[model samples]
Target: MSSEEEGCFVNILSRNISNIVDALLHGPENAFDEARKEGLLEREDLDRITNKESNGDKIRACLDIIEGKGNEKRICEKCGQEAAKRCVTCGILCCDQHLKRHQQEGHNLMDPGVKIEKLRCTVHGDLFKFYCMDDWSLICPKCKDGQHKEHEVVPMGTAPNKLKVVLAEKHCRVLKSIESNESQLHEVQEEEGQTQNAGRGAEDLLEKRRKELCQIVNETVDLMKGQINKRKMEKLSLLGKQKEKLEQQNESLHQEKSSLQTALQEELDTASFLQGSKDLLKRLETMSDFKSVERTPLPVLDFSKEEKNLDGLITLNKNFLEKIEKGPVEHPEKVELDQNNLRRLYGRSPSLDPNSAHRQIKISGDLRTATLTRTGNQYPEHPDRFDVHPQVVSCDCFSSGRHYWEVDVRSSRWWKIGICLNSMGRKGGKSGLGANPESWCLSKLNNEFSAYHNKQRTSLSVPGDHERFGFFLDCEAGELTCFGDSRVLHVFRGNFMDPVKPAIGVWDYYCDSVHFVHLVKQTFITN
Candidate 1:
């Protein structure tokens, strides 16, 4: 062959080897070693390739194809838990839910111990619980004198001894039979070995081959036993849970039965007591007739000494009364209004959406940055504090500061301006923690500014505060003014902030249905 052609063949061989190696390295791990140990791969042909053949690559490839690619996963029909393949009768696939149904419907349910012999006593019909020995009979204890006394009495505890004696006799018979059978088996085995050795080389080779066959069979038997054990454990686990459930149900029924019995007893007692009471009432009525209606009264007399003691006691009580009167007169009661109660009395938005129950939050697109107009009760003597409490009233899906609405006011009066979000409390308590930030109204540039600059909004106190728990609300810019008894709040428009989508959490926690009110550019609509 040309050198170039030879080099090409070598290259092809090397590439094929490399590909095969890569597949083994990265491929599934269902190696045939496990199959061999478990005796599934015990055929002489398979053994020849794996142990005798010098070609390692060919053997590994054969093993991989056989063990790695099969879809033999035994999934439970109920829970889908994987199980080793086994006979369906073994019940490996059943989960707790399905196994309970099996116990009720399957012919072979969980273990019910040996079927006990039932021989009733001649006298009572109760359960027959004992066994007699001499006659090999079953009977209740009461039957001892009637029927079982003539029999040599042996307790059931000594049953093993009786069984042993019977088994010993059988063994003697079986030993004789086995001796005869062994002679026949020996002849058969020798003949069989000779027949097999016709093809094989020597006696030792044949014997070794025979032993290997036995070992393979034994390995298969062991694998079967392992499968059976695994199946039984799974079934027992399922049954344990079902049994626990049934036990709970049984206990409940027993308690109900006990309660019924007690109730019946109580009713019987009540009826008996009522009848006895009726008899006593009749006796009392009859006795009343015997008493005189208007006879000479028993003498009414009082001792003079006792009368003087009573007078002394009355005088002491009079002095005590005078001392009590001389002391200060205590106020009867003072009425006060619960501030939180007043806030509850001040209700929220007219209607609530049904989805509100699930805490579904939505962005408040309507009311954004509104001028801090002096609300009902927080207006101060001076009004410059409206700008002092610059606030975001509501927000939309976008949350860039650029898209925000701004509110400003220039009023000469000193005012206590505030910012607040309109939100409801969870479970009707305070929103924000225990304190409600839903109805938050900020303090003006009043003495409270120094008091609350460092503290949280919940800590900021209003004398007549309502439910105002405050959190961060991205707001749009707007403006408002305050004068006389009236105040005006306004929203000056701009594009919404870019890119800040609505938060699923804060939106659901905050506003209800928000109503947007756009006033003509410059109008005081306040009354």
Candidate 2:
């Protein structure tokens, strides 16, 4: 079709559509409602909302709005207008004006038909029964007299007071629920706004990435095409060189033939010339054999592979950028909780003696080749940093000044270990607890996070579970075995650099086979 004709048709169709929309919007009773609600509803919108299939939905929505369902009701009690069913007992009402006052006044009223009924006496008609001193129901006056009247009787005034207290409690609970739900709703709205902002950020990133991709594509096209052209030129130059070589060979052959003809003029030299010419021709033939050299192929970008890698990198970049914008890193403090230190902190172990300051834990070979073994807590004074380790652990730094150690549980004995770190060196500060800083997986699996510390075992590698919390020191690349002789419950790993420092270690309660073998030197982990 002609462009002009297409444009004319599009304009006519658009006008017709607008007219049809106007008619559809202003068609019926709800047409006015729609106009007031959201201006005019176009024909397409009307069709979607008022189709036969959606009639039930429309009716339900209308009922919800008209009948005040799924909406809060506020009315003025003084005006007596049926604003909403704010209270069933008092029939409280409100309008736009005095709604707040009515809400405050009628909010304390008891629910209709919800009050406890009086237990009437069969013998004495009007007087209500009284509650017994014991945890029993109310008794009539006659029954009280017959049952020997010593039981406590709630006074008439007491009933009202008790009911008021109960009702107040109920109202407070309702208010609290409303308040809590509103607070949660506000938080959700804020979170939603943040998510939308993140989406906008993602869109902006996508646009930037699109520009970069376009630039890359243009550059790639140029490079690839230029490479192909360069290959073509190289092939042409090689072919020209081969042609020159062939021409030189042909000329030399022609010269040899002419020399042979000159020699053939003498009969005696004829045979020799012919033989020599044949040899020369053979040599010429060998030189004329040109090996077909293939031209180098163009470099393939493997754009698909590159595109996948770029996609991953871009996604990571977007995530990283968003994280940087979000900004949640202020740096958290860590605690080093080992056996000797834990016991000392918990008042089990004693403090190091000032008089006999020679108490020491031995350090031998390099952490990688040597072993990190603990004797027991030698201190006899301070119990604040006490722990329940099977042996006392004191740290010894290796020659390289690297701290490495291991914790070996006694045997297949049932035990547990816990570990904590105190990076701030605060004596009594708040900290998370349990073996791991995650969840509480119960029974044979329940794990919880709790903050705790130990004082005696100042700095040592520790590793353990919640039930048996202990500090952990990085062992060799060997598997970390647990529980029993079977390797079934082992945590396997590869190798890592751990000689940097001696980390706190938490280990099993039993002294069975628990051993710490450091790969480097010992690290003195102090504040």
Candidate number achieving the greatest TM-score relative to the actual structure? 2
lDDT of 2: 0.31
Model 2 agreement with the true structure over 1-527: per-residue lDDT tens digits:
33333223222322343343354445534443543354322344344445534444544333222223212323233453334323322333334454555445533222212211222344564233344433234455676776637765553223334433433443344344435434444444444343333323333344455665554433333333343334334334444554454444445444544543443344432112222334433443443232222222211212232223335442333333343333222112332334333222211111111221112222223221111225543545533232332212223321111121233333313322322221212122222122232101111212322222222111222234422322222323222212222112322232222211122222332233323332221111111
- Lowest-lDDT window of 10 residues in candidate 1? 518-527
**What is candidate 1's CA lDDT for residue 65?**
35
Q: Using lDDT, give the best candidate's number.
A: 2
lDDT of candidate 2 at residue 90, scale 0 to 100 = 31
User: Which run of 10 residues does model 2 get worst, by summed lDDT?
Assistant: 437-446
Per-prediction tally of clashes: 29, 101
Model 1: per-residue Cα lDDT over 1-527, one tens digit each: 33333223222322344454444444412333444454444455244444533445554554343322222332334455442221122323344555665445421221111111122244664324344554445455677666787876543334334534543443344344434434444443444344333322322333343444444333332332333334334334433444444444344434433433333334332112222233333432343322212111111111222222222332333334343343212211421222232122211121112222122222232322122222322323322111222222222222222111112222211222222222332333232221332232223333232111113443333343222221122223321111111112212122222222111111111222222222221110000
Q: Give TM per candidate.
A: 0.17, 0.23
